[model samples]
Target chain A: MDNLNVLDIFKALSNETRLNILRWLREPEKNFPAQQAHLPKEVSIEGGVCVGDIQEKVNLSQSTVSHYLSLMQKAGLLEAVRYGQWTYYRRNEETLAKITKFINEEI
Target chain B: MDNLNVLDIFKALSNETRLNILRWLREPEKNFPAQQAHLPKEVSIEGGVCVGDIQEKVNLSQSTVSHYLSLMQKAGLLEAVRYGQWTYYRRNEETLAKITKFINEEI
Candidate 1:
Protein backbone atom coordinates (compact mmCIF):
# COMPACT_ATOMS: atom_id res chain seq x y z
CA MET A 1 0.00 0.00 0.00
CA ASP A 2 1.17 3.54 -0.77
CA ASN A 3 1.38 6.37 1.71
CA LEU A 4 -2.24 7.22 2.56
CA ASN A 5 -2.91 10.76 3.67
CA VAL A 6 -4.87 11.05 6.88
CA LEU A 7 -7.10 13.62 5.23
CA ASP A 8 -7.90 11.31 2.33
CA ILE A 9 -9.04 8.63 4.71
CA PHE A 10 -11.03 11.17 6.70
CA LYS A 11 -12.67 12.56 3.62
CA ALA A 12 -13.90 9.16 2.59
CA LEU A 13 -15.46 8.82 6.01
CA SER A 14 -17.17 12.22 6.21
CA ASN A 15 -20.64 11.39 4.97
CA GLU A 16 -23.58 10.72 7.29
CA THR A 17 -25.09 8.07 5.05
CA ARG A 18 -21.84 6.28 4.48
CA LEU A 19 -21.10 6.36 8.19
CA ASN A 20 -24.42 4.76 9.05
CA ILE A 21 -23.82 2.03 6.53
CA LEU A 22 -20.53 1.20 8.20
CA ARG A 23 -22.02 1.23 11.65
CA TRP A 24 -24.89 -1.03 10.62
CA LEU A 25 -22.40 -3.56 9.35
CA ARG A 26 -20.79 -3.81 12.77
CA GLU A 27 -23.65 -5.95 14.15
CA PRO A 28 -25.35 -7.43 11.15
CA GLU A 29 -27.97 -9.43 13.06
CA LYS A 30 -29.12 -6.55 15.22
CA ASN A 31 -29.04 -3.94 12.48
CA PHE A 32 -30.22 -5.91 9.47
CA PRO A 33 -33.21 -8.08 8.81
CA ALA A 34 -32.94 -11.68 7.68
CA GLN A 35 -31.65 -12.11 4.13
CA GLN A 36 -34.29 -12.23 1.42
CA ALA A 37 -34.15 -13.26 -2.21
CA HIS A 38 -32.11 -10.22 -3.22
CA LEU A 39 -29.76 -10.61 -0.23
CA PRO A 40 -26.53 -12.53 0.12
CA LYS A 41 -25.97 -15.09 2.93
CA GLU A 42 -22.57 -13.69 3.87
CA VAL A 43 -24.34 -10.56 5.00
CA SER A 44 -23.83 -12.21 8.38
CA ILE A 45 -20.43 -13.69 7.63
CA GLU A 46 -16.98 -12.65 6.42
CA GLY A 47 -17.96 -11.39 2.98
CA GLY A 48 -20.06 -8.34 3.98
CA VAL A 49 -23.45 -6.88 4.86
CA CYS A 50 -25.92 -7.48 2.10
CA VAL A 51 -26.78 -4.52 -0.12
CA GLY A 52 -30.54 -4.89 0.41
CA ASP A 53 -30.28 -4.79 4.20
CA ILE A 54 -27.93 -1.84 3.94
CA GLN A 55 -30.39 -0.07 1.69
CA GLU A 56 -33.20 -0.70 4.16
CA LYS A 57 -31.29 0.69 7.14
CA VAL A 58 -30.07 3.81 5.34
CA ASN A 59 -33.60 4.38 3.97
CA LEU A 60 -32.14 5.43 0.67
CA SER A 61 -32.86 4.17 -2.80
CA GLN A 62 -31.02 1.01 -3.73
CA SER A 63 -28.95 2.78 -6.39
CA THR A 64 -27.72 5.54 -4.07
CA VAL A 65 -26.60 3.22 -1.28
CA SER A 66 -24.93 1.01 -3.84
CA HIS A 67 -23.03 4.01 -5.19
CA TYR A 68 -21.89 5.12 -1.77
CA LEU A 69 -20.67 1.62 -0.89
CA SER A 70 -18.78 1.48 -4.14
CA LEU A 71 -17.02 4.73 -3.35
CA MET A 72 -15.89 3.55 0.08
CA GLN A 73 -14.74 0.21 -1.33
CA LYS A 74 -12.74 2.00 -4.02
CA ALA A 75 -10.98 4.04 -1.35
CA GLY A 76 -9.97 0.74 0.33
CA LEU A 77 -12.34 1.24 3.22
CA LEU A 78 -14.79 -1.59 2.35
CA GLU A 79 -14.61 -4.93 0.60
CA ALA A 80 -17.39 -6.33 -1.56
CA VAL A 81 -18.48 -9.84 -2.50
CA ARG A 82 -21.02 -11.01 -4.99
CA TYR A 83 -23.19 -14.09 -4.60
CA GLY A 84 -26.13 -14.96 -6.77
CA GLN A 85 -28.13 -11.75 -7.27
CA TRP A 86 -26.80 -9.94 -4.21
CA THR A 87 -23.67 -8.11 -3.11
CA TYR A 88 -22.29 -8.03 0.42
CA TYR A 89 -19.85 -5.54 1.89
CA ARG A 90 -17.44 -5.60 4.80
CA ARG A 91 -14.59 -3.54 6.24
CA ASN A 92 -11.03 -4.29 5.14
CA GLU A 93 -9.03 -5.06 8.29
CA GLU A 94 -5.64 -4.74 6.60
CA THR A 95 -6.43 -1.21 5.48
CA LEU A 96 -7.82 -0.48 8.91
CA ALA A 97 -4.53 -1.52 10.51
CA LYS A 98 -2.50 0.41 7.98
CA ILE A 99 -4.55 3.52 8.68
CA THR A 100 -3.96 3.10 12.42
CA LYS A 101 -0.20 2.67 11.98
CA PHE A 102 -0.06 5.52 9.54
CA ILE A 103 -1.73 7.85 11.96
CA ASN A 104 0.47 6.64 14.82
CA GLU A 105 3.81 6.92 13.00
CA GLU A 106 3.27 9.51 10.29
CA ILE A 107 0.50 11.79 11.54
CA MET B 1 -15.78 11.91 21.34
CA ASP B 2 -18.89 10.63 19.60
CA ASN B 3 -18.97 7.77 17.13
CA LEU B 4 -17.24 8.96 13.96
CA ASN B 5 -18.33 7.79 10.56
CA VAL B 6 -15.54 6.40 8.41
CA LEU B 7 -17.02 8.18 5.41
CA ASP B 8 -17.09 11.55 7.15
CA ILE B 9 -13.40 11.27 7.99
CA PHE B 10 -12.62 10.02 4.50
CA LYS B 11 -14.50 12.87 2.86
CA ALA B 12 -12.45 15.41 4.76
CA LEU B 13 -9.21 13.77 3.67
CA SER B 14 -10.14 13.32 -0.03
CA ASN B 15 -8.90 16.57 -1.48
CA GLU B 16 -5.49 16.62 -3.16
CA THR B 17 -4.50 19.88 -1.51
CA ARG B 18 -5.43 18.63 1.95
CA LEU B 19 -3.56 15.39 1.30
CA ASN B 20 -0.38 17.24 0.31
CA ILE B 21 -0.54 19.42 3.41
CA LEU B 22 -0.68 16.29 5.58
CA ARG B 23 2.23 14.65 3.72
CA TRP B 24 4.35 17.75 4.15
CA LEU B 25 3.56 17.80 7.86
CA ARG B 26 5.02 14.31 8.23
CA GLU B 27 8.58 15.72 7.82
CA PRO B 28 8.46 19.38 8.60
CA GLU B 29 12.22 19.92 8.32
CA LYS B 30 12.59 18.62 4.79
CA ASN B 31 9.30 19.97 3.50
CA PHE B 32 9.24 23.50 4.87
CA PRO B 33 11.77 26.26 4.51
CA ALA B 34 13.10 28.37 7.37
CA GLN B 35 10.27 30.16 9.10
CA GLN B 36 9.73 33.69 7.93
CA ALA B 37 7.40 36.43 9.15
CA HIS B 38 3.85 35.13 9.56
CA LEU B 39 5.33 31.69 10.25
CA PRO B 40 5.31 29.96 13.62
CA LYS B 41 8.29 28.16 15.20
CA GLU B 42 6.27 25.06 16.03
CA VAL B 43 6.38 24.22 12.37
CA SER B 44 9.15 22.04 13.75
CA ILE B 45 7.65 21.21 17.14
CA GLU B 46 4.83 19.17 18.71
CA GLY B 47 2.54 22.18 18.29
CA GLY B 48 2.25 21.90 14.48
CA VAL B 49 3.47 22.68 10.99
CA CYS B 50 3.28 26.42 10.31
CA VAL B 51 0.49 27.81 8.17
CA GLY B 52 2.87 29.70 5.92
CA ASP B 53 4.96 26.61 5.20
CA ILE B 54 1.79 24.70 4.45
CA GLN B 55 0.70 27.53 2.16
CA GLU B 56 4.01 27.42 0.33
CA LYS B 57 4.01 23.65 -0.13
CA VAL B 58 0.41 23.39 -1.26
CA ASN B 59 0.84 26.37 -3.62
CA LEU B 60 -2.52 27.70 -2.53
CA SER B 61 -3.60 31.11 -1.36
CA GLN B 62 -3.14 31.77 2.36
CA SER B 63 -6.88 32.03 2.90
CA THR B 64 -7.59 28.77 1.09
CA VAL B 65 -4.96 26.76 2.95
CA SER B 66 -6.08 28.28 6.21
CA HIS B 67 -9.66 27.28 5.48
CA TYR B 68 -8.69 23.75 4.54
CA LEU B 69 -6.65 23.30 7.71
CA SER B 70 -9.50 24.62 9.77
CA LEU B 71 -11.90 22.16 8.18
CA MET B 72 -9.64 19.21 8.90
CA GLN B 73 -9.12 20.44 12.43
CA LYS B 74 -12.87 20.77 12.86
CA ALA B 75 -13.31 17.22 11.74
CA GLY B 76 -10.85 16.21 14.48
CA LEU B 77 -8.06 15.34 12.09
CA LEU B 78 -5.70 18.25 12.81
CA GLU B 79 -4.93 20.45 15.78
CA ALA B 80 -4.15 24.13 15.33
CA VAL B 81 -2.21 26.60 17.43
CA ARG B 82 -2.19 30.35 17.15
CA TYR B 83 1.08 32.03 18.08
CA GLY B 84 1.95 35.63 17.49
CA GLN B 85 1.02 36.36 13.89
CA TRP B 86 1.16 32.77 12.65
CA THR B 87 -0.83 29.57 13.09
CA TYR B 88 0.71 26.10 13.30
CA TYR B 89 -1.15 22.82 12.85
CA ARG B 90 -0.51 19.21 13.77
CA ARG B 91 -2.51 16.00 13.75
CA ASN B 92 -4.69 15.13 16.74
CA GLU B 93 -3.54 11.73 17.93
CA GLU B 94 -6.53 11.01 20.14
CA THR B 95 -8.93 11.50 17.29
CA LEU B 96 -6.62 9.57 15.01
CA ALA B 97 -6.68 6.61 17.35
CA LYS B 98 -10.41 6.86 17.67
CA ILE B 99 -10.80 6.82 13.92
CA THR B 100 -8.55 3.78 13.54
CA LYS B 101 -10.39 1.92 16.28
CA PHE B 102 -13.75 2.86 14.85
CA ILE B 103 -12.78 1.49 11.48
CA ASN B 104 -11.44 -1.69 13.03
CA GLU B 105 -14.41 -2.32 15.30
CA GLU B 106 -17.31 -0.69 13.52
CA ILE B 107 -16.50 -0.60 9.84
Candidate 2:
Protein backbone atom coordinates (compact mmCIF):
# COMPACT_ATOMS: atom_id res chain seq x y z
CA MET A 1 0.00 0.00 0.00
CA ASP A 2 0.89 3.71 -0.25
CA ASN A 3 2.40 5.82 2.55
CA LEU A 4 -0.99 7.07 3.84
CA ASN A 5 -2.38 3.62 4.70
CA VAL A 6 0.96 2.67 6.15
CA LEU A 7 -0.13 4.84 9.10
CA ASP A 8 -3.04 2.43 9.59
CA ILE A 9 -0.60 -0.48 9.54
CA PHE A 10 1.41 1.33 12.23
CA LYS A 11 -1.81 1.86 14.23
CA ALA A 12 -2.62 -1.83 13.90
CA LEU A 13 0.86 -2.70 15.14
CA SER A 14 0.86 -0.22 18.08
CA ASN A 15 -0.94 -2.68 20.37
CA GLU A 16 1.34 -5.09 22.22
CA THR A 17 -0.77 -8.22 21.83
CA ARG A 18 -1.36 -7.58 18.14
CA LEU A 19 2.35 -7.01 17.54
CA ASN A 20 3.18 -10.21 19.45
CA ILE A 21 0.65 -12.16 17.40
CA LEU A 22 2.34 -10.99 14.20
CA ARG A 23 5.81 -11.79 15.59
CA TRP A 24 4.58 -15.19 16.83
CA LEU A 25 3.09 -16.02 13.46
CA ARG A 26 6.62 -15.64 12.03
CA GLU A 27 7.35 -19.18 13.27
CA PRO A 28 4.02 -20.99 13.07
CA GLU A 29 5.40 -24.51 13.53
CA LYS A 30 7.30 -23.50 16.66
CA ASN A 31 4.52 -21.28 18.03
CA PHE A 32 1.29 -23.17 17.24
CA PRO A 33 -0.03 -26.47 18.54
CA ALA A 34 -0.04 -29.53 16.35
CA GLN A 35 -3.30 -30.37 14.63
CA GLN A 36 -4.23 -33.96 15.53
CA ALA A 37 -6.76 -34.14 12.75
CA HIS A 38 -5.74 -35.24 9.29
CA LEU A 39 -4.18 -32.44 7.36
CA PRO A 40 -4.87 -31.53 3.78
CA LYS A 41 -1.80 -32.20 1.69
CA GLU A 42 -2.22 -28.85 -0.09
CA VAL A 43 -3.00 -26.71 2.99
CA SER A 44 0.42 -25.82 4.28
CA ILE A 45 0.84 -24.63 7.87
CA GLU A 46 3.27 -22.10 6.37
CA GLY A 47 0.24 -20.35 4.94
CA GLY A 48 -1.05 -19.38 8.40
CA VAL A 49 -2.00 -20.44 11.93
CA CYS A 50 -5.63 -20.78 13.01
CA VAL A 51 -7.23 -18.27 15.41
CA GLY A 52 -7.78 -20.96 18.06
CA ASP A 53 -4.10 -21.90 17.95
CA ILE A 54 -3.02 -18.27 18.33
CA GLN A 55 -5.35 -17.64 21.30
CA GLU A 56 -3.92 -20.68 23.08
CA LYS A 57 -0.40 -19.21 22.85
CA VAL A 58 -1.28 -15.56 23.68
CA ASN A 59 -3.47 -16.22 26.77
CA LEU A 60 -6.05 -13.77 25.45
CA SER A 61 -9.78 -14.20 25.02
CA GLN A 62 -10.84 -15.72 21.70
CA SER A 63 -12.75 -12.56 20.82
CA THR A 64 -9.73 -10.34 21.57
CA VAL A 65 -7.43 -12.44 19.46
CA SER A 66 -10.02 -12.55 16.70
CA HIS A 67 -10.37 -8.76 16.79
CA TYR A 68 -6.58 -8.28 16.64
CA LEU A 69 -6.25 -10.70 13.75
CA SER A 70 -8.99 -8.85 11.88
CA LEU A 71 -7.26 -5.49 12.45
CA MET A 72 -3.91 -6.85 11.35
CA GLN A 73 -5.54 -8.30 8.24
CA LYS A 74 -7.26 -4.99 7.55
CA ALA A 75 -3.92 -3.18 7.85
CA GLY A 76 -2.42 -5.58 5.27
CA LEU A 77 0.02 -6.75 7.92
CA LEU A 78 -1.52 -10.23 8.00
CA GLU A 79 -3.56 -12.35 5.62
CA ALA A 80 -6.51 -14.40 6.84
CA VAL A 81 -7.68 -17.68 5.41
CA ARG A 82 -10.86 -19.39 6.56
CA TYR A 83 -11.17 -23.18 6.59
CA GLY A 84 -14.59 -24.12 7.92
CA GLN A 85 -15.15 -22.25 11.22
CA TRP A 86 -11.41 -21.79 11.82
CA THR A 87 -9.69 -18.68 10.51
CA TYR A 88 -5.94 -18.93 9.90
CA TYR A 89 -3.78 -15.80 9.94
CA ARG A 90 -0.21 -15.10 8.84
CA ARG A 91 2.01 -12.10 8.08
CA ASN A 92 2.04 -10.81 4.56
CA GLU A 93 5.81 -10.82 3.96
CA GLU A 94 5.57 -8.61 0.90
CA THR A 95 3.83 -5.90 2.88
CA LEU A 96 6.30 -6.27 5.72
CA ALA A 97 9.17 -5.85 3.28
CA LYS A 98 7.46 -2.84 1.80
CA ILE A 99 7.24 -1.27 5.25
CA THR A 100 10.92 -1.99 5.91
CA LYS A 101 11.88 -0.38 2.62
CA PHE A 102 9.61 2.58 3.18
CA ILE A 103 11.09 3.14 6.63
CA ASN A 104 14.57 2.93 5.20
CA GLU A 105 13.72 5.69 2.73
CA GLU A 106 11.26 7.81 4.69
CA ILE A 107 12.55 7.49 8.25
CA MET B 1 15.19 0.12 25.40
CA ASP B 2 13.65 -3.27 26.16
CA ASN B 3 11.33 -5.23 23.86
CA LEU B 4 8.22 -4.33 25.86
CA ASN B 5 8.65 -0.56 25.42
CA VAL B 6 9.15 -0.87 21.67
CA LEU B 7 5.35 -1.06 21.56
CA ASP B 8 5.26 2.46 23.00
CA ILE B 9 7.62 3.60 20.25
CA PHE B 10 5.24 2.19 17.68
CA LYS B 11 2.35 3.95 19.37
CA ALA B 12 4.30 7.22 19.35
CA LEU B 13 5.08 6.69 15.69
CA SER B 14 1.56 5.67 14.66
CA ASN B 15 0.51 9.21 13.89
CA GLU B 16 1.44 10.87 10.57
CA THR B 17 2.44 14.22 12.12
CA ARG B 18 4.72 12.60 14.70
CA LEU B 19 6.39 10.39 12.14
CA ASN B 20 6.82 13.31 9.80
CA ILE B 21 8.38 15.34 12.60
CA LEU B 22 10.90 12.61 13.24
CA ARG B 23 11.63 12.23 9.53
CA TRP B 24 12.02 15.95 9.00
CA LEU B 25 14.33 16.19 12.00
CA ARG B 26 16.65 13.81 10.18
CA GLU B 27 17.59 16.78 7.96
CA PRO B 28 16.99 19.75 10.21
CA GLU B 29 18.87 22.43 8.26
CA LYS B 30 17.08 21.50 5.07
CA ASN B 31 13.64 21.11 6.64
CA PHE B 32 13.59 24.16 8.96
CA PRO B 33 14.36 27.84 8.54
CA ALA B 34 17.87 29.05 9.20
CA GLN B 35 18.49 29.98 12.84
CA GLN B 36 19.91 33.52 12.55
CA ALA B 37 20.74 33.98 16.22
CA HIS B 38 24.31 34.30 17.41
CA LEU B 39 25.77 30.79 17.70
CA PRO B 40 27.03 29.05 20.76
CA LYS B 41 29.79 26.84 19.31
CA GLU B 42 28.66 24.15 21.73
CA VAL B 43 25.06 24.51 20.61
CA SER B 44 24.96 22.25 17.59
CA ILE B 45 21.91 22.27 15.35
CA GLU B 46 22.92 18.67 14.85
CA GLY B 47 21.83 17.95 18.41
CA GLY B 48 18.16 18.95 17.85
CA VAL B 49 15.69 21.46 16.50
CA CYS B 50 13.60 23.72 18.71
CA VAL B 51 9.91 22.96 19.43
CA GLY B 52 8.93 26.31 17.91
CA ASP B 53 10.78 25.41 14.71
CA ILE B 54 9.08 22.00 14.57
CA GLN B 55 5.73 23.69 15.15
CA GLU B 56 6.31 25.93 12.18
CA LYS B 57 7.27 23.05 9.92
CA VAL B 58 4.33 20.83 11.04
CA ASN B 59 1.68 23.58 11.16
CA LEU B 60 0.57 22.34 14.58
CA SER B 61 -0.23 24.14 17.81
CA GLN B 62 2.62 24.54 20.32
CA SER B 63 0.97 22.26 22.87
CA THR B 64 0.22 19.57 20.29
CA VAL B 65 3.79 19.59 19.01
CA SER B 66 5.16 19.62 22.55
CA HIS B 67 2.91 16.70 23.52
CA TYR B 68 3.96 14.63 20.52
CA LEU B 69 7.63 15.37 21.18
CA SER B 70 7.24 14.28 24.79
CA LEU B 71 5.53 11.05 23.71
CA MET B 72 8.25 10.29 21.16
CA GLN B 73 10.90 11.03 23.78
CA LYS B 74 9.13 8.81 26.29
CA ALA B 75 9.06 6.03 23.69
CA GLY B 76 12.84 6.41 23.18
CA LEU B 77 12.24 7.23 19.53
CA LEU B 78 13.47 10.80 20.06
CA GLU B 79 15.76 12.67 22.41
CA ALA B 80 15.18 16.13 23.89
CA VAL B 81 17.41 18.75 25.46
CA ARG B 82 16.75 22.11 27.08
CA TYR B 83 18.57 25.05 25.51
CA GLY B 84 17.70 28.21 27.44
CA GLN B 85 13.88 28.58 27.36
CA TRP B 86 13.43 26.33 24.27
CA THR B 87 13.36 22.55 24.30
CA TYR B 88 15.08 20.99 21.31
CA TYR B 89 14.19 17.53 19.99
CA ARG B 90 15.86 15.06 17.65
CA ARG B 91 15.74 11.38 16.72
CA ASN B 92 17.69 9.07 18.98
CA GLU B 93 19.90 7.29 16.46
CA GLU B 94 20.94 4.48 18.80
CA THR B 95 17.36 3.76 19.86
CA LEU B 96 16.22 3.95 16.25
CA ALA B 97 18.97 1.49 15.28
CA LYS B 98 18.02 -0.79 18.17
CA ILE B 99 14.43 -0.80 16.94
CA THR B 100 15.54 -1.53 13.38
CA LYS B 101 17.63 -4.41 14.71
CA PHE B 102 14.73 -5.66 16.82
CA ILE B 103 12.39 -5.65 13.84
CA ASN B 104 14.98 -7.47 11.76
CA GLU B 105 15.33 -10.15 14.42
CA GLU B 106 11.71 -10.31 15.59
CA ILE B 107 9.66 -9.62 12.47
DockQ of each: 0.50, 0.71
How well does model 1 score by local distance difference test?
0.71
Candidate 1, B-chain TM: 0.80
Local error of candidate 2 at residue B17 (angstroms): 1.0
The true-versus-predicted C-alpha distance at residue A8 of model 1, in Å, is 6.6
Task: Count backbone overlaps in model 2.
Answer: 0
Q: What is the C-alpha local distance difference test score of each model?
A: 0.71, 0.79
- The DockQ-based CAPRI class assigned to model 2 is medium
lDDT string for model 1 (B18-100, tens) is 76677677666677777444544544446367787788778889899888998888877788877776678887767778866
Error of 2 at A80 (Å): 1.3
What residue pairs are clashing in model 2?
none
